[model samples]
Target: MQLLAQVLVNGVLLGGLYALMALGLALVWGVLNIVNLAHGALIMLGAYVGYYLFTLLDVDPFIALPIAMVVLFCVGYLLQAGILNLIARAAMFNTLLITFGIDVVLTQLAQMLFSADYRTINPGYAGANFMLFGITLPWVRVLAFAVALLLTLAMWLFLLHTRLGRGIRATAQNLGAARLYGVSPKRIYALTFGIGAALAGGAGDLYGVVSQINPYIGATLTAKSFAIAIIGGLESPLGVVVGGIFLGIVESLTALYIGPTFVDVASFGILVLVLIFRPNGLLGSTT
Candidate 1:
């Protein structure tokens, strides 16, 4: 029973980070209607940014997070404004192809610059842990989870209370209506994408502190993010948190009982079930 409780705790913590990882992808998809295949690549870049900041400049990963976000925001803004805007009127398939191409290019660039070596951001206290109610909790994971939840809440607040947030929601609902309200769709779209990338960068920063990262990890991360986004429902930020926690718990249980190898099978199996039964997501409604 103690073991089970510990596992559950671990799963919940893992879920927090998972939710952060998927938030950006969900945001971009929900707002821009652009299924950015390069979303994961952007995440990889952020991880590298955090990694280098920690290793080269001796900056804390937590402190380096905003720096990574700012850099990725610029990258995202440029990509959306300079390239994606030109193809805004293109078909969904074309957009997908273009984004996929961007993903490939980013992956190659990452491989060339960082190599295929697995790297992790190891702070002085990374290995420290504290016992709580018979369960051991690592400081790094705890901090990562806290940051993740904080960012998720911050994003939710941003979407609900801010002027730009309303503009983003309006644009998602109807581009024409948003335009009439003096909301420039082009600027909003770019800003939305930039915010998405910034969120990805933040997630990646935390991820590097807790996991091994390499260029090739992007594809797998992208798949997991998509699964979480769909399962949680893109209707609201809370949905992603729910989905991430659900997946994290499922994966943890599967690893403990069925074997570690079947974790993906269990996760993806649940995703398939959710897709069939609740196409709108567990927390989302069909519009």
Candidate 2:
């Protein structure tokens, strides 16, 4: 029973990070209609940014998160405005190809600059942990989970309450009508993409505190993000959160009961099951 409780705790913590990681991808796909194949590469960049800030400037990873987000936001904005904007009218296939190219370029650049070695942010409190009812909880994981939940809630509020948020949603629903209402589609698209990148950066910052990061991690992370996004559905932020937690718990149970090697199999298997049975997602409306 104690073992089961600990496993559940671990799964919940893992799910929080997964939700944050997939949030950016879901946002871009839902709002901008962009699949963003390079999303994981952007996440890798953010992780590096956080890692360096902590290593060189002695800034704590938590403190450096906003800085990474800002930097990635600028990068995302420029990418959309300069490159993607030119092909905005092109086919969805074209956008996918372009994003794939970007992902390749970013991966190569990361490998060249950061090398193939694994890196992690080792804060002073990294090794600390607390026990609750005989279940041990790592401080870093708890902090990361808290931050993830905070960001998710904050983003949900932003989308529902802010004027700009409504405009973005409007653009997503009806680009022509949005333009008719004086909302600049181009600017809105760039801003939405930038926001997505900012979310990815924030996730990366927290991810670095919890996991080993490397240039190659992007592809795998990207796949996981895609699965979570699909499983949760792009309809709402809450859907994505639910999906992430579900996947995390499933993976944890699989790892514990079956084997660590079966984690991906279980996760993707669930994704396949969900796609077959509920094409819209567990939280998504059937209509």
The number of the candidate with the highest lDDT is: 1
Candidate 2 lands at a TM-score of 0.98
Candidate 2 residue 85 C-alpha distance from true site, Å: 1.5
**Over 4 Å off in model 2, which ranges?**
none
- In the range 76-155, model 1's lDDT, one tens digit per residue, is 99999998988774788988999899999999999999999999999999999999998999999999999999999999
lDDT digits (tens) for residues 1-287 of candidate 2: 88888998899999998998899999988877778899999899999999999999999999999999999999899999988887775777998999899999999999999999999999999999998888999999999999998999998899999999999899889988999989998898899889888988989888899999999888888888999999999999999999998989999999999999999999999999989988898999887
Error of 1 at 176 (Å): 0.8
Q: lDDT scores for all predictions?
A: 0.92, 0.91
Q: In candidate 1, how many clashes are counted? A: 0
